[model samples]
Target: MPLKELAERRAILHRKSDPQTIVKHALDDVQLGKVAMVSSFGAESVVLLHMISQTAPDTPILFIDTEMLFPETLQYQKDVAEELGLTNVQVVKPSREKLLEQDVDGILHTIDPDACCALRKTQPLEDALEGYDAWITGRKRYQSGSRAELPVYEKSGRKIKINPLADWNAAKLVAYIEEHNLPKHPLVARGFQSLGCAPCTTKTKPGEDPRAGRWRGQDKSECGIHIVDGKVVRQRNAA
Candidate 1:
């Protein structure tokens, strides 16, 4: 039941399994206890979503609508769920009271992106994951940064975080999507490789890292939602 022990055990058991098999195990393993899939429904999201749909259509899928997300992303989330027939896609968002108290005017991201992420994303997700013992993520090594050496299974706080596609590369994901005819995020067509909140996300140029567009020109790469290898990075508002 310990995070490390559980993660190591599951990793060893599924060392040779593919992403889909790992997904099935995550959803069906009773030890995981009410596992849920957290998706951004951004570019490259449909692959894992499609996998979950096939493995367990009723699995709870958490989609954090930072509310500052692009209009295209908003619609894409709805379209992907309906297209996949995912039965339990829960829309998570920062509470109105928290928003009013910390990010009134919705411009906190302009001044302090870290605190903004904490209020909008990390805090809300932590609240949403209250009863779940494990959660699935769509992270892949090919995306680079701290994620470059990501493991298939890792311990996040008290929860077991499973990265089914940790080893998958962009080419492999493209091939899989094309082979399965999975739908892509609408912004992908306009060169947005990694999708996040609309204001913080930008278009990734050719030959740049897929996530180069996120928090562009800033020192931040992750939204604190994934600051999880060992440190729990949450920026609190001065207020």
Candidate 2:
């Protein structure tokens, strides 16, 4: 099916259902090789990775290594992928030439993070997702200001984006992780409630928003991977 029609269909089915039910139904439509799960391998990522590993260990898992991530995050990604015994994990990366061409100055993120994200993340994944009909994500509505109203399913160009935890809160995510004994990003233990690129993330204070550490002190929230109504907008700022 075309992406728009599939999205419309998904929306119709998810009108009143919860996130788990939506994921269950989406899995039923899987044909083994047509779907993929895209994970940020961030703080709250383990829950969805665990779910997918349990649901379909053989499913291709796409992990985008933005090349700017923390060493701990890269290690965590490797650790989780191995521990879960995920058979088809593929690490996608931005081209070296592209990185050199676009960000040789290394301050593109400082001047325009949206462009940096587009260069390192969005473009790479968009290219990698060429043949996949749908991809799963771990976005929860309560994570940040921008994601406060996320939907279970969304249309992104020619692909279907599924947010299986759209209705979940932080407490629920923590419970799920603890119950599964899931591995979290190492930075999480050091007060980094959220994890992104090394330069863009920081440690949050008590009672600060979970995503307050991302792009700290900057007016950037989301890394442009997910957009709203076809326009990219920052969901939160690291205050």
Candidate 3:
């Protein structure tokens, strides 16, 4: 389909429906070359994972294993995907050669998180999504100030980014998880509302922003994926 037609459809869908309706349409779009669900499999990700499992289990689910992630998160990802019966779970990772060149000591999160993230999270996915026309995310507006104005569909370069749960809140996420008996990210109960690389993430305290646990003290809130492209683009916005 032409970009104009898709833009018009996105506008109408954004106004007339709920998250599920919007998500369904994006999955059903035939003109997009390929679509994938980039999930962190963090606290609120189960809602979207479960939705896609039911609506389109065969769709590619890209999970970035930054190699710095929590072990609990790794296990949780495996369990959730299997339990949901989601097929095509692709694990994307940064290359060892690049790590040796750019982040040799592996303490890049201490020196420069954005650069580390670009190498570990963004580039690999960018390579992975060479021809994909769009991807879906679980980001919600209530998570942070930057994402407060997130739209269901965003045109990024030549690709369409889908935030199926853009209107969902903390309570809605909890309700979905409980209602579906979805497994929580292993760190949530310990107060990690957001999960990212182990070196950068911390546990959130009461009254802090939902994503305060991520890149804790750094002024950086995003890992640059949201600003540019790939789960490759799914960077800093999601869990």
Candidate 4:
């Protein structure tokens, strides 16, 4: 099936459904039998992860560990998986040899963030997802920038990208987390609204976009993972 048609058909089928229902439909895809969920396991990650744990506990969950990530994030990833009984958590990382060659000093993020992300995140994820035909993500439209127009379903290459939470907002996220008593990323209470690699993420101030804390001073918003169809779409920085 074509990616566009697949996304459209699924979107129509789940038009009136909730985010969890959208997730369930993606998990049940016959053509894309081996779907994976890519999660950051950051501040707002628990919602989708918790949904996946109930909908498909065995589904592979990809967690890209940029060597630059916060220690809290690493521990949060482990704790979340254990707490949810997620059995197929796959840890993806840039190869040691490549890191030694391209970013030996670990300062690539300072000179070229795009290269840094491609080296640590994009390429590693692309390599890890070689055999999968579809993947689920935790993006929401309210996150801003190009994501402000995010769709519930979209096709990327031969795979269908499902954004089950595309319509959710901060209020919904907060309510869901509190209602479920989900654990938060340790940095949230410390004023870090968005959690990414420690070196890139910073503290968000009052009335700022939730993601303002990510890549604080840079012109970048995303870490190069949220490509739109075939084009590399850069998100807006600073709400």
Clashes of 4: 0
lDDT of each: 0.89, 0.81, 0.82, 0.88
Residue-by-residue lDDT tens digits, candidate 4, 1-239: 77798788887777778999888878987865689999999989999999999898999999999988999999999999999999999999999999999999999999999999999999899999898988999999887666877778888866789999998999999999999999999888999888888888889888888888887777788887878765677756845
For every model in order, what is the number of clashing pairs?
Answer: 0, 1, 3, 0
lDDT of 1 by residue, 28-123 (tens): 888878899999999999999999999889999999999999999999999989999999999999999989999889899999998999999999
Sequence-dependent TM-score of model 1? 0.95
Order of candidates by TM-score, top first?
A: 4, 1, 3, 2
| Model 2 vs. true fold: TM | 0.89
Model 2 error, position 188 (Å): 1.0
Off by over 4 Å in 2: 1-5, 12-21, 30-33, 235-239
Model 1 residue 184 CA deviation in Å: 1.2
lDDT minimum window of 10 residues, candidate 1:
230-239
- Please provide TM-scores, in order, for all candidate models, with all chains considered together: 0.95, 0.89, 0.91, 0.96
Per-residue lDDT tens digits of candidate 3, residues 1-239?
76546755785657757777777788888865578888988878999999898888988989999999899999999999899999899999999999999998998877878889999997887777776888898888899877877777776656878887988899988998899888888788898888888888888878888888887666678777775422323334233
Which residue pairs clash within candidate 4? none
Better structure of 1 and 2 per TM-score: 1
